[model samples]
Target: MKTVLKYLPALTLAAGLALSAIPAMAQQPAAKAGAAPAQPKSSPAAIAAAKEILSMKNASAMYANAVPGMVEKTKIALIQQNLNYQKDLNEVAQVVAQQLNGRQNEITEGMAQVYASEFTEQELKDLVAFYKSPLGQKLITAEPKAIGLSMAFMNSWAQNFTETVMGAFRAEMRKRGKEI
Candidate 1:
């Protein structure tokens, strides 16, 4: 559990990215019988377009904006997992922050693969153009704040949901006159 907690931030980011890809993958049309399987890497044109889209979205900057929140959340988890390591908390957080930033290129590369596979080169170009537009830029700027708010809301909802579920479980146990 402690080891899991230590890697929680990376896992969370990875899971979030992976989950976001699901809808994109689902939206793709089914290939005809005997069609070639999807390749692991995209074609050069698609890769170029994906990079442009990423640039237009300022993907790295957005992740950097999100880092503070990630750091704070990780700090809390570390404290919970290692209460006796108060003196090393700051150093640990600094190291985590550095590691997260260092991995941004790898994350962006994975994202580019997802985009390239899910979208044609033309589609990626269109997306890049849209992101370069004012409205798309507005969304890009707003996304980090939206993500933070969404996380907070989900956390609160989960707490309430857990309490509700546990209450129901206790009621059922009492009804059965079961002692624990």
Candidate 2:
């Protein structure tokens, strides 16, 4: 238990760094204009905002927020506390996985909406071309794994950290004859 606790922070940080690195793949490059310099289809500001909102960071944060409720739900379904910990953990993992999958869908859908509003058909074609390149495909593959690993690491870290902190606090309260 202590060994796991000791390495939790390192694992969490590594997972976070890995996840943070995954999303650069899908980022659209600067739009190139053809001979006519096609009147810059989308406002640069709107494009920037859409990119920011649809970014991996934003998606990961949303996933992170959804995980605790999942964990709690698992805990509440106790059959036998000791025997069920692993089972509960597995269930929570599934929940997080599903949430990440949904988030990726959301990001894709949001991008489609933005493209519809911001770009003409030709400009959308140009954007799709860039995303279909090798770099774009790599990003698409990596982002989900990054998200999953990061969430798993953080969930473990949070559970352990909460246990540690709450254990100490409860001990202190017990010493003071206070009900926790």
Which candidate comes out best when scored by TM-score?
A: 1
lDDT against true structure, model 2: 0.53
Q: Write the per-residue lDDT of candidate 1 for residues 77-160, one digit (tens) a residue.
A: 888998998669978888878777665566678778877887777877887788789987786667545555566677789999
How many clashing pairs per prediction, in order?
Answer: 0, 0
lDDT of 2 at 16: 41
The residue pairs that clash in candidate 1, if any, are none
Name the lDDT value of residue 154 in candidate 1: 72
Could you give candidate 2's per-residue lDDT for residues 1-180 as a string of tens digits?
A: 455444444344345445433543235455556643233446554555445434522343443434455555655555346564777666766676566544444544555454444444555455445556787656555655555565668789999999999999999999999969
lDDT of every model, 2 decimals: 0.71, 0.53
